[model samples]
Target: MKKKIINGFLQILGIMIVGAIIGYSVGKIAGDSLSKVDTPNIILLLIAGVVVFILQVIIHEAGHLVFGLLSGYKFISFRVFDFKIIKDENGKLKIRYERLAGTGGQCLMRAPEYVEGKFKYRLYLLGGVIFNIIFSIVSWLILPSYYTLLFALIGFVLAFLNLIPMGFNDGMTFYHASKDETTRFILHLQLEYIYYQSIGKNLLIEKPEIVEKINSLEITNTNYLTDALEFIKLDGLEYFFEFDALYNESRKLYIERDDLLPVYKVELMALLVKLISLVNPEDELLEELMNDKSLKVRLKQNNPQTKNILATYENGVKLDDEKALNLINEARKIKNKAPNLYIQNLEMKYCDYLENNIIK
Candidate 1:
């Protein structure tokens, strides 16, 4: 809490300094001309500018806090000037707030992990923007022309700018959280294509039982295929092949169509071998897979698909052990080299699995 207060004070102080610099420069440039008119009025404008800047920070963050609470998020802590402190009740930390510098200013609302469902997630993310827009609109109507116009501009900028559908922005997070079906489909198709390419060359390793297992299982729809492919991509061929083999043996049911499988068992075996290489940098399989013509063809064709698949994987899965252990292990090995692609899935999977299998 003390830290938050101090940080808030620093932020306000920084804004004031910047405001002062701008005011001083403007005053120097037009001070003589303005002196001929009204000294007091000019001073008022200067104060207004500084106050507006500071107020902007407060209102912006307040917008986030207001909407966050409305959307059912708990407040952590708030800072005004120059103090930092934390409040805890029964070991549950009180609300916390962090100032987001870019994207028209933002505050992260850390909700409890138990808060699941898309509505809650969406509300939490969009809360600040919504409140900012509302405040801006109201300020424009009520405030005098000078301040009204400024507030309106700030509001418009925050709303539209934050809505850009890209990394770390609200729009991207919202879109992924919403689980737009088209996005999911494209992602699924792309991942399967990548896996197909990765394994196209190693047909010689005859794992008949595994082949027979995957073939027997009923992978009826594109969705299931996508899920299966994602599992393989994250888990690596070793775990996937075992799972597939087990699934096949358990189901012993035929899929309605051959095209449903996308590739044959021999092809899958080769693909797994190729994938095994990429799983770990030090693994021997990389060289052999790299040289294989069929694998190269599939990889080239599937690169785009892989990217989409990765995005979809991120959107749907929240890191858990049973879901993507291989990805987690690889990421752990590489430190910062790990891609954010499957981290969420790995965390959720591990946590859930451990909770159920080990903790329980």
Candidate 2:
């Protein structure tokens, strides 16, 4: 607890220092431009700022896509906010709407084949930072207008934040990957696993070696990579109907991992509710999880897995079979519409399991 508090304090201090630097830069650049105007339109400036931030985010993710392709990684999906361009099962790009908590945008790719314990990783990982920095410089050099200044400033700040290992950002991943052999290997495995999922291949069955490797990793919660691998392991366990193991692991991560990502944490909590309901509907954890206002808000998303878990909870614990059936039906309807085909397949199977084996 002391360590976590110290880390949190350090992170806040770093952010404040960086913010001060960026603020001074912004003021210096914008002051000259503002001096020329009789009155500044605050609302217009605010709108422009928002637009510039979004554009920079797009540019950053695009950097990842371009560099990932160059590094021999295959594109899976690119998202800006809720809008996404994803490759469908037919190997064609399609537009979809999806949102991931704690991310402004994402660029996912199928990693190139791992050979001799190594693969191209640096370019793909640092692509966004490189792009943001390059664009910042280019934007500043091209024009001296207000929009240009904002663009340059925002881009630079984005690059800086991502280039430093603060959180689960690109810089953090790259930093760990460059230093740790295990991190690199884990990235390779994750990318390959994503590729298999994109093509409707189950790593657990067809690539049991991959599953074994993933499950063998140490879950120190020191980095997001370990947590991610553990999440994948949970999926494999769930795939084989090992609810006992799933519940225990999910509970362990949810309770023990103070550094757990919000995305993983919420999913685990929801999964726990479902598991407890299935195994022992009378478990006290169910009441607490179900009544959690924060968890309730997060679970209100349109995600298939969340809906499936909610469906199970309603059926087994609440005895609201009608609502449970509706939730499962809704999950099935949107399963194929998921950005990742692997998740789509998983949700479909889960729905089937609930209907055929559990929900009846």
Candidate 3:
């Protein structure tokens, strides 16, 4: 808690220093321009810039605070001037600020709890954008000309930019919230390309056999299917199902393929594991899958079916002791080959579950 508070304070302080420097520069420029025609007070212009900076930050962040709270999000912290950091108990963080250019501003709200479900997520995403647009229009109509016009313009620009729906910006948040299948599929493809490039592999050459197999299947618009297959391979089949539900027609193609049975069966088993885990932790099906060495080894392959199996088993253990034992057995089978510190942590958790719950 102390660390977070300190970090927030430093972030705000940094923004203040940057804002002040920019404000001073703008003040000097405006002051110089007006020197001949009545020489407007440099001090006054600087003060106005500071005021604008403060107001922009307040209104921008206020949009996030008001709308976020109104939309069922619990209020975290609200601050103005420099960078504003807000966080709920769930560790979700939102940061707000005005650009030094003084044209407009932004409030970025992150809600981890906001994941899943389309409509509620969309509201959480659009909350800040909506606030800025409404506030900008209201300011234009009611506030005095000088400051009001500036604020309105700032609001308009920021709101417009945020609605773009790309990258790490607010638009991406809106897109994800919408759960638009096409957009997600495309984004997944792009991310995959980046991932392969990062790993120094040419995706085309690296998976010629898989690509050839996909082509031989005579899939229409093979790019989409290929990408979908690849994503399933990398992330897991659950995400494939997520994408498939959006593009329901794709399911027909998968159903017709005899060679795809292994993948499909694995996915089915994974889904069943998930369902059983939800009903009871001591589900026999989950235990069977966990105890099977072949299933555990297959999971290490990082295939879509394997990923879903692991994920299902993990979620299942959270709900029941029988499931946890099953998951522990599964973990023990391939403990040496499991990837990353996360898997190591899972191993520890399974051992703890066995010791404290299974024996008892």
Question: In terms of TM-score, how similar is model 1 to the real structure?
Answer: 0.34
After superposition, which runs of candidate 3 have C-alpha atoms over 4 Å from their true positions?
1-50, 77-119, 181-360
Q: What shift in Å separates residue 7 of candidate 1 from its native position after superposition?
A: 33
Clashing residue pairs in candidate 3 are 165-171, 281-320, 281-323
Highest lDDT model number? 2
Question: Considering summed lDDT, which 10 consecutive residues are worst modelled in model 2?
Answer: 213-222
Model 2 quality (TM-score): 0.90
All candidates' lDDT scores? 0.42, 0.80, 0.47
Q: What is the lDDT of residue 68 in candidate 2?
A: 96
List the candidate numbers ranked by lDDT, top first: 2, 3, 1
Q: Looking at candidate 3, what is the lDDT of residue 154?
A: 57
Question: Candidate 2 or 3, higher lDDT?
Answer: 2
Q: Candidate 3 on 72-142: residue-level lDDT in tens?
A: 55444455533435442345654432112122333333233322233234554566678777876776556
Q: Against the true structure, what is each candidate's TM-score?
A: 0.34, 0.90, 0.33
Compared with the true structure, the alpha-carbon lDDT of candidate 3 equals 0.47
Between candidates 2 and 3, which one is better according to TM-score? 2
List model 2 lDDT by residue over 96-140, tens digit each: 677777789999998877874567899998999999989987886
Candidate 1 residues 44-84, lDDT tens each? 66677666655665666676677767766555434433221
Error of 3 at 178 (Å): 2.1
**Candidate 1 all-Cα RMSD:** 18.2
